[model samples]
Target: MRQKVFNWGRYPQGDVDLLPLYYLEELDELTSKPCIARGNGRCYGDSSLSSQVISTITFDKALIFDKKQGIFKCQSGMQLSDILDIIVPHGWFLPVTPGTKFITVGGAVASDIHGKNHHTEGSFSKHIIEFEIYSGEGLHYTCSAKEHPDLFHATCGGMGLTGIITSVTFQLKKIESVFITRVQEKARNLDEAFELFEKYSNHTYSMAWIDCLKGGNSFGRSIMMAGEHTTLNELNAKQKPEALKLLQGSKLNIPLDLPSFMLSGLSVKSFNELYYHKILGKVKQDKTYFDQFFYPLDAINNWNRMYGKHGFIQYQFVLPLSTSRAGLVEIMEKIRNQGSGSFLAVLKQFGPQDGMLSFPMEGYTLALDFPFRPGLLKFLNKLDELVLKYHGRLYLTKDARMDAEVFKASYPNLGEFINVLDKYVPKRSFSSFQSERLFG
Candidate 1:
């Protein structure tokens, strides 16, 4: 248990692990040497990779809470799930959440993750009031928008390159229950997809699960899901009583990965057809479980292994809505022409981004998961070219392949972001796969 532990990469291919450091004393001791700390190891690529990774999960501890203010503080390794179990029933939730709630609070800050409500709530950092970060100089300090403000911005999405996040404080939203009242629409093609996005721009959360293999007039055909938390009074007493209990239960994890080919294109196509039929139309206000809605893939343990040992790569990019179609079309074309049809593809509209170096922009973003194969780099590079042509950018948290030149171009504001970055630690230390591969 004290040895190195790795993950399936979600891309379902590479086998990489972290040298777990389960205590704060271990983390402090790591500063003398180049090191990066990570939690859950969920980032698809090497962003969390480092010769020395302080697995901060042992740092887990609930430090403070004020119900009236809805402001909560806890150790960096605290999982959002831990907070949700206590707060959701009380009618408050994380102001924002990523696709899966399995991520740690520290990881959320390091990545500046955005969620379905991004258009409205922005990224996780927007609601973060403050956090405790141990710097490269072996010094510990607290930072926020008001104190060491420069480091605050840098650490927001700095990928933990400036310091090891120790503890964090954030504002939680009060919610009625763990249920979402959603509306679904089926689009015949990408054009219809755009129309629906524009039409439902006001929803608290909006996203689309696309069918990537289908092209032509039907390219980007999808099911646009729009929703918000259901109010307590809106539900019957019977449902309310059940909702509270569901939040407290433990969901089982996918214990082992399946045979890689279990998620082949042919099989995925059939699944997509079924999903389109089931979720696309006006379905009743059917009772939904948070696990299913928020973390679809989490249901199946080691689900990525369905892609086989080659491991698939996730290609995700955001394009200003004005150019989403053209950029998307070109990228989709490249994927299909390369005979690399992804098993799962998703599309969503990003609202205005507030983070200085946030990944989500005011536009449309698409993510595709495909089985790994030779020539993938060539295909992804071509897609990156198309993304750049449209003034769009890629998600570094989910990336394992992009180079620094491309990254610098993707975020020209990086200079300003980096200026904010160096202030956190005058010694200029800390590391991540990103620091090694893209920021070196």
Candidate 2:
């Protein structure tokens, strides 16, 4: 059936022929078409948009799980939330997770998702033992780091163009409790934020909520947060009994689109000021549930509606460690001077990346949300030039309209990724609108 589909960002939506794959046998017929597999649709871009799309939502199921060894094998369509439901009680958690838990396991691998722990654990694919993929040429193969290593690397961040992932087996992280011992510190400016990040370099998770609207001395002011999984001994009297309890689903919902004016510079600046001061003192410590600490946005259903029906673009990019400070200063200055404010600005330090097309490297990454208003893309294009000048690149998962020239210049390993795709999906039967836009 033809239906309109949009990624989490709700932008660049289009009508497509949607095919739901309920059984493994169904993939045989779908492989011949040019399509991309759709997970929970949280990519925030058009990477999963195409004329034909295979919906993997119904293909979710756990194939095997060795609780004792913390090994899990599940169908690609399984969501992180579902896995958390089964593993949290067993003291296991995802090795690496993005901000949201609604994305599918396949989507995680495809984007090679990273998290607050990227400086420690790397990307989601690093812990992957193996995965089964049905190639565009009607070939099925089980790939891993040792076997078909090239295919394994390419598929990890290939944006689903190499093929459709069927099942994945990966290692799970063990946890003593479902709580996180969190510490919040205020960084009056970008320099202080960098200092605090270095001071807490040993922490398992670290990230910051930056106030991108501020200029001059207050520019880049942020609240830095670091956390580690809480142990049973850390739980207080009332929390000891249910230390491993799972999180409940969100009750809050933004039923309709909000007024676009609600996110104006004045409103956003006011909100940022309030949020920055909400931390109280220079430093604060507390124990929070894993869900609250890792996925705060998940607490509100249909939260994307807050950007209005026009949708928003999540502009995320990373600069090489050597150039991060200068690059960020220039980028933030441009944003400030433009008078465009991003209410949700996140900054994090990344250690390294492994996959050929993976987004991260040893650097600092910043993400901002911009309403899809006129001239936003043109403005972002200018930012792209600065990123490239600093030897940085935009994340493909968050990209909606990056040009081919910029895309090619940013990823030095593009040739290798293309070679793997050509070798496996020679007919190019697997493709997406974004793939054509950036790769063709």
Candidate 3:
């Protein structure tokens, strides 16, 4: 049935026919139409949007779990949160997890999602052992680094254009507890932030909450957080009893769309100031629940509504390690001059690139949330030019408005990715609005 659907960002919404695929058999029947697989719809943009969407929500099922080996197999629709519930108590965790636990296995593979540990563990596809996919020709193929290598690479970050991922088998990281030993350091400026990141490069996970709204002497001031899984021996007396305790349900929620004015420059600036000062020290150390450290925003439901009815776009891009410092200086100046500041700005160091279309590379990646407003798109386009000038590219999973020319210039492997799609995806049989927008 045709219905309106929106991604997590809630921008570029459209009405599409959503076909629910309940059983594996249904994959064959859906081949008659050009459709993209839709999981929990947590992607930030149009990558999952299409005229015909094959909903995998009902296909969720845990197929096999070798707890001893920390290996799991499940249907594409199984959510990361669900996997956590079953694994955390058993001392296993996702090898790589994005900021949210609301996305599905299929979506993870499609986006080749990276997490705070990208500098150490790479993206989600790195841990995937193999997966089953139903191609546009209604044929099932098992893909991995050793088998159908090209399809595996393309499908890993193909944005669901190559086929519908039915099931996935991946390795999990074993943990002694569900708590994280965290250290927070205050960076007075951009240079200190970079210094801190490099200084603590050995930490299992690291990221920074940057104050993009601030300028001059305080420009790029941030709280650099680094953490590692707390071992059983490191747990406090009170926490030892529940070392592997699972995260409880979130109680906080944004019940309604906040007024647009709530996110105005003045308001956001205030929030940033408060958040930055909340640490109360130059360096602080503490132990927190895994969820708090890895998925802080997940504690609030419908938090995207905080951006207001028009929604917001998450602009994430990476610059080569050599040019990152200079590139960010230029981009930050441009944003400041334009009077557009993002309160929710994140900075992380990525280790290396994997997969044909994966977003991560050996560099620093910055993500910022900008409220959808007039002139914002034009402003972003200008920033896009600066990004390309630095030899960087925008993340496809987070993109909504990048032009075809810009995308072509950024991704040098576009032709290879397209070749994989052309060979496997029958003409118009499996595609998305993003694919059309970028590849057309």
Among all candidates shown, the one with the greatest lDDT: 2
Query: lDDT score, residue 43, model 2?
Result: 96
RMSD of each: 2.5, 0.9, 1.0
Task: Return the candidate ranking by TM-score, descending.
Answer: 2, 3, 1
Off by over 4 Å in 3: none
Better of 1 and 2 by lDDT: 2
lDDT of 1 by residue, 1-440 (tens): 23444443554232333455556676656667677778877777777766667777777888888888899998998888787777766667888888877788999998899888888878888898999898866578788989987778878887888788999999988777778887788888888888988887898888988888786787778888888777778789788675555543444555555675676667877887787778534433454656667777766656666666566677789998788778888877777666567665889888877555668898988988756667777778878888999999989888878878788898866887777666666555677656777877
Question: What C-alpha lDDT, on a 0 to 100 scale, does residue 413 get in candidate 1?
Answer: 69
Q: Candidate 2, residues 33-53: lDDT per residue as tens digits?
A: 789999999999999999999
Per-model clash counts, in order, read 15, 0, 0
Scored by lDDT, model 1 comes in at 0.77
Of the two candidates 2 and 3, the one with more favorable lDDT, higher being better, is 2
Ranking by lDDT: 2, 3, 1
